[model samples]
Target: MRFKYSIPVVFVLALVIIEKENNIISKVSDKLVLKQPPMVLDSSSSLQLLLKPNQSVPSFHFHPRTSAPVFTLMKRRLEDYSSHQPRTQKPKQKHILLLATTRTGSSFVGEFFNQQGDNMFYLFEPLWHVEKMLTLEGGGTNASASAKAYRNVLQQLFLCDFSLLESFIDPPPVDHITSNLFRRWSSSSLCADSVCSPFVQGDFEKFHCKARKCGPLNLTLAAQSCRAKQHRAIKSVRVRQLDMLRPLAEDPRLDVKFIHLVRDPRAVLASRMVAFEKYKNWKEWGTRGGDVPLDDDEVMKLKGNCDNIRMSAQTGLRQPKWLRGRYLLVRYEDIARFPMRKAAEMYRFAGMPFTPQVKSWIARNTQVSPKEASGVYSLQRNSSEHVEKWRFSLPFKIAQVVQRVCRPTLKLFGYKVVNSEKMLTDRSISLIEDKVFNSL
Candidate 1:
């Protein structure tokens, strides 16, 4: 009976204290809702301090000196302020790798992403620096070591980190600074005012940006520009194997996409003969119009180049778990025939917007004068016409040799083999079979 009496006393005390708090609150204004706090039982004693809810809705009792209406308004404001939505974070940056062999229309395809304006950060042949430096150090000639080095540099570049690249820069960048980035003018991102200001009034003429026209490339500024971009893309003809990029693809920080570009072996051989001064021997070989030795260095080189491209294509087409929804194979012939359509497809694969600027650039560059398309390394061309132009220039004997050595590559990429010299040089007949290498 005494314990029950003590319980009532405790409840009364709790109620009195709550009532006093309410009185102070009432003096301010009458509109504020009075919410009862939870009733709690004391473990040490038989005392129960209880608070009964006035209604289901949340009610607050503010202090004295504030009117009920003022308190209510303040309470509403507090509630409204406290219930604000969480901030939305930006999506992970898209890291794109454009992989191809030399003279495969990679420059033209790379420009598709490079011309995406400020939102994109594109680098052209950044691996060239690595290969150059490593070769000087005698490590580049070793294929495995060189591929690993290229991968490391590429990984850093995609992260917008230039620290590793600085190590490979010619004359070596002092304190993360360098002016001699390989093909510096090739990447619009590097040429932008953000990275390097133009020394000359017209830094960019037609499609080419002359390096002399621009100031030294500040790596710090380049990095800042890279991070500011929503996407990053690097074009490389150096790294040979598609499987070599597994680590980069599986990286948690990057959303990576690999775009592999391939051209017909006959076309590649023909173009290499014209473009590279080093291919003079090949030119001599073709002009001789004799049987090409299968064991000869030049013939072996042709076989190796074609075989590597074929193998890489095969690997990408397999679409292993690490590379799923990330690998795309594009035939240079298909891109040449359909520039806008193929470019849009590539941009779509990389999850980038295909803007009108790129569209306009494609239109202007792809249908230039013969003079504009003359450079050995020129991206400007009459694309559709150039696809079959190889047939006219490439000797039938040389074409046969390419067919013999690169038969697997030809069949895989949908290039038809010719029976005789007449068939090899005939532009009237189509050699490219209808094929789709790039699909969602």
Candidate 2:
């Protein structure tokens, strides 16, 4: 009786082992089945049933002994499904850099690009903060390092990265009467279409912004708007050297193009003097503090700036054919005299179509009368009238000084020198009133 009982126990143990081996084989078959078509789901079908689009896991009957393996296979199939899904491709954006100096009508040119449409994004003086940072870090005097830093900042900006511009986004307190108007103006102009739009339009119900304060929301919107554009442009007066931007111009990823905006140095000088005087009067009234007083040093600095502008233009025009193809020299005078014609050419150079909307914008902005409130500094002005104002505004002595200093620059840009003494005694001088001269 003891021997018979032991034999039954041995037979039972052998059957259990065989069952375990079958379960292992079933799991292997399930995995192999994944490789076959989903239609092949007969009894011989391997693990691939999990991949069928409409099939439910609960609909399939698994052997009770192999339930754990079925659950494991289901989990893996879900993961594989997720991993095999398609991904979206990012849209390619064009990058444009406008090379110019201060008071060269760069603002107008920048705005032209910005106003092209909702699809175009423009940045104004993005390098201002970089210059400030360099000064604070004692790298301002290091030309090579400063240029490299500027290029890096520009690269990040072209890629729609605004993380680096956070500190510079702070607007002045509106209550601070001594804040520089020009600084406020620059910040306001730069953020107008983007960060400050809702606030500026008094759309409090839509967006809330504290008086003269810009928060993260502003930066985010600006970055998003920039990233959404098919074309991106940045205008800077700090980058006076074309060579400083050679690497960016040649960058394969950027599809970069350069617009070298040249202005008559004499006109530039005259404008600077007039602006300096106005700034001085503003400072004297204590409406602003930390203003740079016009002194011999300031004069020398202005002269140096003019020289650099001239040199950059001259150098760019003289570049070799391969490099020259990437650059387009646009004269402030020509743009002022014939905005629509030049604008079309500029758009073509930028590889964009000159649409009707752009034409309408050009007409609206460039057709203002000479007596308009913002005729002096506003982007909206009678282009011809505004361009010729310098001729009447600069005094004979000042004109002579500017002419002598900027002779080569003026010649390079094809600007004819006016006879200062003759002009001073002419009827043109009679047209400008004492009030206009004082205003200048």
TM for candidate 2 is 0.62
Runs in model 1 lying further than 4 Å from the true structure = 1-89, 136-140, 197-213, 438-440
TM-score of each: 0.77, 0.62
- Residues 1-440, model 2: lDDT tens digits: 54334333433433343343544544554464454344333443332232334423232333367654333454354445444657577655668788887678988877678676767777767777767656744344467776887887888888887665543433432321112212323323234456553333432221233255432244555667777678888888888577778778767778788888878776776677666674353223223344334454545555677788776766666765545566788888788888999888888888877878778878898887656636456778888777767666665655555666667776666666667567644645432211100000
The backbone clash count of each candidate, in order, is 6, 3
Where is the poorest 10-residue window by lDDT in model 1?
A: 40-49
What's the CA RMSD of model 2 in angstroms? 17.2
Q: Model 2: number of clashes?
A: 3
Whole-structure CA lDDT of model 1 = 0.77
C-alpha lDDT score of every prediction, in listed order: 0.77, 0.62
User: What stretches of model 2 exceed 4 Å from their correct place?
Assistant: 1-92, 136-142, 167-218, 277-296, 373-376, 424-440
